[model samples]
Target chain A: MRQILSQFGTDCDSGAAPRTMENWYEHREMIEINIVVCIKQVPGTTEIKIDPQTNTLIREGIESIINPFDTYAVEEAVRIKERIAQQSKEGFSGPESKVIAITMGPPQAENILREAISVGVDIGVLLSDRALAGADTLATSFTLAKAIRKLEREFGKISLILCGRQTLDGDTGQVGPELAQQLNLPCLGYVIEVMEIDNKYFKLKRLMEDRYEVFRVPLPAVISVSKGINEPRVPSLRGAMRAKSAPITVWRVSDLDVKSEEVGLSGSATQVIKVFSPHIERQSEIFTGDVDTQVEKLTQKLQSLGVV
Target chain B: MDYFLSDEQKMIVDIARKIAQEKIVPVRKELDEKEEFPHEIIKEIARADLFALFVPEEYGGLGGRIFDVCLAVEELSKGCLGVATSYAASGLGFLPIIISGSEEQKKKYLSDLASGKKLAAFGLTEPDAGSDASAIRTSAVLDGDEYVLNGTKQWISNGGEADIYTIFAMTDKTKGARGASTFIVEKGTPGFSFGKKEEKLGIRASVTRELIFENCRIPRENLISREGMGFIIAMRTLDKARPAVGAQAVGVAQAALDESIKFAKTRHQFGVSISSFQSIQHMLADMATQIEAARALVYAAAKMIDSGAKEISAASSMAKLFASDVAMKVTIDAVQIFGGYGYMREYPVEKMMRDAKITQIYEGTNQIQRNIIASHLLKSA
Candidate 1:
């Protein structure tokens, strides 16, 4: 019975019933699982202005915050880790899981990573380098994938990769899929819920245009979560203090062993040729009459507009 | 104008403001109407590690200073002074331990208090002890390894809800103020009970009950500092905490001013916004100026206390006195700006006015604060 139960959750379970402590030890190895969550810090305010000349954002005085959508992804990852821990406590014998938050931006991006730690992320990694500036989505995804690979090398196997469907600043909704391609893993987009997980496979609920679909995929997959997945928790004071003192591992282009050219603007496959705000045109008409006459006029107007 | 907060302090302010806006604001009115303790909000605050702000990190705290606590209190008070009082009053109860507890005592008590696992209350006020704390009639007599205490502490915040209490009693009545001693008593101790809760004009969300100790026995080791040090400890604690009350006052005052400005801008009379009237503008100007001055004084006093200044009695008293007065005046002006609407309970300024009055009364009345300031000035002269 124990052997049958073991196969349901563990990879090291052999087809043998353990009769001694030594035999039990030989049958299983304590699985270590790490979840990598991607986060981005965007300007706090929506009243952004683009420099007409440089075609760049005016970020000199604006406050920055973790991308709002990304917070949902981070929250979902923490929730999944917590669930796994709870299951472990209930004799599930699941792997010990840790949520690791990763970000690629200026050195100040470490602030978002610190925030992630303050809200239950176990580790934080910042991919910061002057050379990585001006990268488009493709190059950005490559750099992040390289950083994830570096994290894996240091912290052992990563069981899951999570990201927000899109960032507020970029809103491209492309990085998650591109990173999934770069890492050669099965990718699921618009994930709204995590149904179940074990050592070998996991189940996720992906949202579609008009409905939701559940899918079971193998371990070590990439999942891009939507904003509706979960409500993020506020950082506890103890968590904040811990994050204040927590050591964030800062990795540069050199640290990831990636070619400098492929990581920054030089490796980008796309560039913005022009940027401008679209002008909106408006027109209005007023009908002056009694209520019945006004209703007749509105009907005639709608009919003239091909309404019937 | 040159007041600068550290990055950590700024982060604390941001977190506290978020809590006030997101968590406290929604339930503030209901809590006041129901006269309910904000248990969930307090838990949230504790989870955020705010309770540990003034606690040293060595004792499982964030190791923040009095300035940090003032910043947090001000932000929370902006949402509701009643809820803020519950938070600030806990800090008041724990200050004696932080200020005078021995290493062993600190280790035993400060850790849980800092972690917010247990709420604490200060028991110094009685029917006869208001303003004149030296007149407390509570008595504590030594018997074997324990001290038997008998007293009724009135109008104590967090009275029945708190788990630990720092109570003062006269050990030798012949010595007057010097006869008193402070002791740490747990809630479950036999003969320790609470009296009827008081219905108040404002800050109604906070519990104000009588702490009745009838032959309450506690370990002699529970005595903080030494015999006859209760008065000194109480005074020192109040001096440090007075600015926190000032911060609370500033918060309520600022809230009232903000409401008035918004109301004035939207309210119209004779085809023009009331805000466009020079008379209303002048009232707003005076309110804003006084509030700024009060805030400056409160922050300066808090900073001085955090800087370990020994002679801050005058500054603390001044901060409390000026800020509480400004709170009352500003709130009243805010009501006037609202006209008849402000007089109605439907508006918030009236509630603010009620809350502001307590700041003047509690933690040593404004009158007592004036006395303290004058005594310090005369002594210095």
Candidate 2:
């Protein structure tokens, strides 16, 4: 898998290239750093409950969590806002940074978005409608990009877009990069550490297979975070109480000022033709012997499978 | 600290109960019989960020007050008391160092423990000192820069699996309670080993073993309180921990009552369900009432602990005594309600009945609790 991915690795691996020169803080005397963290609500796993009688998913009892990976994205956005607020207080007075969490899922996902707000995000927006039920990655990205643009129009120009590396249910790792591509934003993936940040630029350590590469990405860049990007903090009791009634803005395709054909099934490029449980076959041969004999048997077994 | 929980407590309770009922109920029997610890369940709870409820925020903990831990304990225990007790004891073994340790100790231990990378065990009850903990014969002799500990602690929960331990040993054997001191002994010390695992009748899934410290040497910094403050420190830790035990009892009792009620209404006897019998109905009613009342006391004690009230010890003892006794009674009644089937191992109520028995034995027996309550009463007199 590593070799396969590395075969397609682009200049994205280059630590140089200076992706964007537009530094918001240096350009304007100040810039409002509005961040929209794109999150998704997905069935946490493929092993979902099926109603035996109906041969359909029992959605009522099923749980929809904030895509597990997205939590790190939401956390990073909130953390950056906190860092900005603290920096501003320490006479590094910059325009106040704000984190607005946006999720495109069913209306029930409002709960998770509200949870994000409780964990110190400034605002929450949910894009939900019956039309978005069968969205593939491409359509999901299009819908999210439009929603981000709409948010920029209503709030302000968002400087940073953050998301998880991939959703647990999808595992495609395409939505975040696709969204960034649609927005024409420079995208960085597998961020492990946020080393330092001022208003205009942020230094981060992007995790690679063998080592970590440090990069100073300019503002407005979309960064996909891996897990272990600093342990996500739990919401305090007071924070949870505040989140219980947090206002969540709901949107639809019409709200995003986008064409309906660019969403849902019509907008999808790829379709899953069929899904079935994979057949698993297991065979075991017990090697009964002393240590030397056992080692010989193991080596023979590995060689038999072309693994040694 | 207030008796009324903020909305967070209620929400946690709701989530935990749903997971317990929907996820844990079906698999609990198999897990128990096979003696398989549910590592995945603990991982799920960890993902929920439950393991840090008591540690302060600076140490990467949630800094949730004692009340929240108790509330969560009750809910989690309802799923499986063994798991809940093991999880909650993580707090018990760490909260002391968190609440009283020097900054160096806090930085050294709290973060790792809070992150669930390490498990902690609290050691105070020795074989001879189960009820009268002042009778502990374990001695910690200051030798050069190290303290040599030699003792045996019995029935220590998480004994075999713990990475760190909060141990109490006598620094001056003559002074009884005053001469005892607390020490934080990391596992894998040369002389710190555990005995065979206890084959428990209840909570068998939770690892319990005898902790043996034979000249286990630790740095001087491992000492928790001042040289003579061991008993006082141990008491303080128990004051915080007792309510959690009570909450565990409540969880066990609540599970029993719920299962019993469900069974009674469905299981028919004499062509008319036993639930229709006035006597059986009375038992169910009593069980429900007892569980609710025990819950109230447990929550109240938890609130008292959180508030830092002077009455905390008394309240904790009251809650522990009442709730655990209620668990014993309620579980027995639940088993009785099941009639012949309740005696069978297949029914969940039977396991609940077995599991509920240990709540009275640990966290200071009900007799010791009464003694503490009586002491508080007589002291005022």
Candidate 3:
């Protein structure tokens, strides 16, 4: 099904002639800055089963949900768009903004993109291809970076990119920084609050292991946020209805200027050899007779174990 | 059990359920305890376009579908009947205008109501009138280009909190019920005011108060329909709104049953889960069955109304009457199953039980619903 859509790639992949300087000048007048949020569809259940041979979670049977942390990212992106749009409402014709969410997974992953739209996302982009399966953080970030560049070319200047700090199942907090590295853009992770933002810079507060660090980062940067940044809104009825019929922009590997060797699993620098659930064992001993006897027995055992 | 809902219907249910579970459920207990209005939650509902469900698409709504409205109401009712009442009562207030208003009225008022930019209330019952709605003494006398309204409308849902009110008043005292007329009254109109908010036995999150009009002046254009059509409009509005009440009952009952089942499974006595006991099992089975039956009836009644059939009085009343009784019984049974825990404020079944009673009493008491049904039955005879 996705193969048919990949053939008629929408928006940016027309492969048309590069616009002349005149066209760029005309388009630059609007100054429509786009906000891109990267999301993933992960298992919605805790009963996840790992495929030992493939070292991946089996996707069948389980319900898919937007990675929990990603919801906060989507909320923040929508909020930024809303804030910018408010200025437009207040008669500031500085620039119009749109929140475009992009996800890379199976065609079924399009559900998450629609879910994103149901809560005020303007557009959704799906990067689906069979070859993109079994990707490590490196390949995932590389492919996402390519998708981001493609989005930037089509949607105009992307002022900020937002992503969840990490995916639930993967729990590897590398994609945001790696994608930023791939794009040669500044990146910040673990952002708790956005204090302020203007055309050029963002004042951000980030919670670390023990203290808080604030940064005034430049625009055109990628930032991954932890949960609790903001509460994601429930889908509005109109938004849900809109999402039901809204067109999902599909991007194939061919849609991007990407080599087959550097676009999917083959693009990764590392691979998982094995996956297993960690087993925990607990041993208990019951001491009888009296409280003193039990205490003495416990102390003797603790002493034998070299605790004192 | 699958209801085999259409994709659109499923979407409506899913969205409402998300709001109910994620937004309403967490704060419902506190709201009930404080007797405070669910203002933030109502704003959330408005933001979600729930207020637009039963309005026409031309008026910035999804579409006028009573069935779709019922689906949303039921899900929300499961979270908190008080919050659901606040949401559904707005729809109730819109019924008069949607059913019988002029084009100018629809164009002027519906857009705001449909977009949830404003809330509305229906004022029909008076201090002396409940089941005998025609006994209302509120009078709207035509004076020059405006109608001067006087008298108090008691127990109005949404009351002062709503921006718009569809008020029923007597245009001719000698004509009795036939002399009634309905008019649109904005909240801050001259000589219009609200009495103190009423304390309620249940559904505490919804605001209710008396609408007092002391020679309140409204333009003649605010009249909903011709004089003497007030009774018909009120009856029709109630009929159209009955399914939603039925849905509310089903929702509250379903919540009670859910609490019962959840509690029963974990609650242990005599070395076993209470759910294993025959008495508890039978009660659960009965509660589940009655709820499904009520749901099916509510769905059918709403569908019949939305099919543009005007002769839906019997069906709508039956849906409301049966479902409310079932809600009352089921909630009582749920509390019984929970034993002592159910009666405590810490648990939810007592609140469900409290909320369920109003469904039977309001929207025309169950006795009135039965009378309407019986009249329809005998008329067919």
Candidate 4:
């Protein structure tokens, strides 16, 4: 195998194979892995206010950041790629892999793509169009699936898809499952750790409320990563500078070859009619007594109110 | 009046500000109280690629300039001046190599420094030479393949922790100021050792110690450029680095003013918020104006240096002098605005006041900075 590879005129001696040869070798080995990370840009501040009348976020003067959870997905994808590359260098013959970050929002959402690139993503693709505004979870998932297919067309078959368990703003843990359904792939939710992975299968730890279960899943799957996957690495200065000049592939609704009525707000099965802040009424009752009596009274009040 | 930052500059500032707020601010008080060297925070900063801001791209750096360094320093200093000093002092340490180092020397030293794999320290000031750098008593005698150095360097920032030191010593005693030469000394050289750490008043979170060189031998190739060029290199490196100190001052001042404004609006006096009072309003106004002016000067000096200006001593000194003064005044006024609470450590204003004092003293005292400005003015006149 080494002789055949060397005969291909690959400068493998320098440890950096040419892109075309590397891709060709991956194809021949039947172990190429492409990972697509679905990310979103949300308001930076947690103190977000919704305009009661308009039912829209007060976005003016607010900065946007990549959804906090999605950062873990990005970090995990990069880590997997790095681990595979390391293994290949150590003669384990692991799959050649790439981590591509994708997002769907307005053109300004490109910022998050650049940010992900700075962290370690190999490629950034933005699905931005006016028609894609006000997308519900289902519509967003559909759009992301289309984007992933587009990426596969350009690169190669994607072996895995990753997303955060839920977005901070929407808090809907639906996109990963919906996207899996759209793409006809097996879905793994709340994946806290990737125990081991090879070309054909992955061993993962699925986090649960009371316990964690280990599962062995086949390749070509979707995983919605939980926060405990890993601590995301900060962007290196060199990576940040590269990201500043990196060309982000921008896809419109047309680019995805989707029907106008099958995406964005128009394609949504559900629409939010009203958004309002829940009203909280504050009431204080003073209990004047000795310490033990006050404690007894508080415990009785808590039991009566079912607060225990 | 029109100050515009490029997209890249804005991105750099944003990243630094995020690290400052998320990592530095939380540990600042504890670090200051314990006088602990912020190893973890520094590692985070290194991971963030901030160490490469001022290094050239060919030398494994980000290819940014002095302006970028100033921008990062300003943001980081806003959280804690001590942390910012640790960050900026490394730049001061390695800048001599960047300014006058040979291609070989740069490749050897700057690559590691730029990658943040190793930290660097500048050692121009000694026990006898603080503002008077020409009075440095450290002597380096020529050997077959090395220069054997003998002297003690005082008040070196990042002294004990840094892996490399750009030290200056007299190579030819007969030449007076012209006799000095700079050499790169690795931390673990045979006779080189560190003295006790100094307990400082402000910027206490940063390490300061004496670098004692008793027959500390370094290869002749470690000498920067040529012999008898040490004073000039040291001066030039300081000229380039002074604006960053200005940026630190600006950050401290801005933080103080921000605290003052927030305090004034919330703290009530005579049935109204103190901000509504004329006296408080005037103080806030003056603080805001001074901080803005100092920031403007610092930015201008940084840009001038980045633009490859040949003579920028006056501008750099002016920036350092004015910004440090503004930092001191604004922090004091912030305390005044906070009234009695400002005097207490519970409020952040007192810490800001403490942190603001060192910007006036180190990197050349404000008095020495005034002297540089006067000299420049006289030469031009």
Measured against the native two-chain assembly using Cα atoms, what DockQ does each of the candidate structures obtain, in the order listed? 0.39, 0.07, 0.64, 0.43
Question: Taking the tens digit of each residue's C-alpha lDDT, what string does model 2 give over B130-241?
Answer: 8889999999999999999998998888887889899999999889799999899999999999998888787766778899999899999999858998888888888888
* Candidate 3 fraction of reference contacts recovered: 0.88
Highest DockQ against the true fold, candidate: 3
CA RMSD per model (angstroms): 5.2, 12.6, 7.8, 5.6
Clashing pairs in 4: none
Please list all clashing residue pairs in model 1, or write none if there are none. Answer: A237-B48, A237-B49
- Candidate 1, A79: how far from true, in Å? 5.7
lDDT of 2 at B39: 66
What's the true lDDT of residue B68 in model 4?
92
Q: How much of the true A–B contact set does each candidate keep?
A: 0.42, 0.04, 0.88, 0.50
Instruction: Give the worst 10-residue stretch by lDDT in candidate 3 chain B.
Output: B1-10
Q: After superposition, how far is residue A219 of candidate 2 from its true place, in Å?
A: 22
Off by over 4 Å in 3: A1-31, A92-96, A195-197, A209-214, A276-282, A286-308, B1-3
Tens digits of per-residue lDDT for model 1, B197-239: 9999999889999999999999999999999999999999999
TM-score of each: 0.81, 0.66, 0.91, 0.84
Q: Candidates 1 and 3: which is better by lDDT?
A: 3
* Candidate 3 structure quality by residue, lDDT tens digits, B210-239: 999998999999998898889989999999
* lDDT (10s digit) by residue, model 4, range B189-270: 9999999999988888899999999988899999998999999998999999999999999999998898899999999888
lDDT of 2 by residue, A27-93 (tens): 2234357888988777755777544653323456568888888889988988888877765554335
Least well predicted 10-residue stretch by lDDT in candidate 2 chain B: B40-49
